[model samples]
Target: MTCKKNMVIIRSFKQRPVCSECQMRSLSGPVSDKKFKKLFDIDPKFYETSAFLRDIRYQYSLYQNLTEKQIAAFKRVVDEFKNPKKKQINAIVPKAPTKEEQAEHKQKRAKGLFQSERSTLRALRTK
Candidate 1:
C-alpha cells in the first residue's frame, strides 16, 4: 500500500511489466503528464495577447537586456496596447435631401402657418 513498497513490488513484477508512468508515480507520487502539459502549453497566438509577454517581462526582469532596437520594439508594443487600432465600422450614411424635398417641406410649413392664421381670423370675426 505504501509508495516505497509499491515501487519495490513494481520493480519485482517483471512478468507483468509496470509502465514508466506507474514507476514515476510510485517514486514521485501521482503526477499527471497530461495536466502538466495542459498547464504549460502555450498557444501560437498567445504572443498577440501581450499577456504572455508581460508575464515573461515580469518573471525575467533581471535577464532582460534592452538595446535601442529592443526598447523601440517595447515602446511600439506599449503604444499598440495604449492606442489599439480601430476596426472599420460599416456606417450607414444618410441620403442628402433633394431640392424637391426641401420645396415640399417649405410648402407644408407655409400651409400650416396659413391655416393657423385663417383659424385665428375666423375666431376673431365670430367673436
Candidate 2:
C-alpha cells in the first residue's frame, strides 16, 4: 500500500510496518465531525473521486482507539461470523434439474424419499 505522503518505505524483509502510534499521529487530535470532513476534502482537481478509501481510513481511525487485544478480539469475531464454510445463503427459486438428474429425482419422488419442484422436469424417454 502506497501512502499519499512519502512517509514510509515498505521493503520485503527489513522494514517495519506502519506503527499504530504513527497512524494516530498522522493528523492528530480526536476526530471531530468538522475535522473528519476536512481530512476528506480532497483537492477538487479530480472530478468525482470515489469515497471508498476515505471511508476505510475513517473506520481505521475509529478502530485505532481500541486496545490491541480488543482489536484482535474484534478481528476474531469478524472472522468467526464470516466463516466461508458456513455460507448457505440461497435463492428462493430453485433451478430446473437436468434430464439425467430429473430421471433420478423422479425415481426418488416415486419412492416418497425426495421432493420434485412444481415445475415439470424434462424426460429422457419421450414415450
TM-scores of the models, in the given order? 0.26, 0.22
List the candidate 2 regions with Cα displacement exceeding 4 Å: 1-49, 54-96, 115-127
Pairs that clash in candidate 2? none
| Worst window of 10 by summed lDDT in candidate 1 | 23-32
The alpha-carbon RMSD values of the candidates against the true structure, listed in the order shown, are 22.5, 15.1
Name the best candidate (by TM-score): 1
Tens digits of per-residue lDDT for model 1, 1-127: 2333334333354333433334333333222455333322333233445542433333233343334555456556666766778765545556779999989979978779768888999999999
Candidate with the greatest lDDT versus the true structure? 1
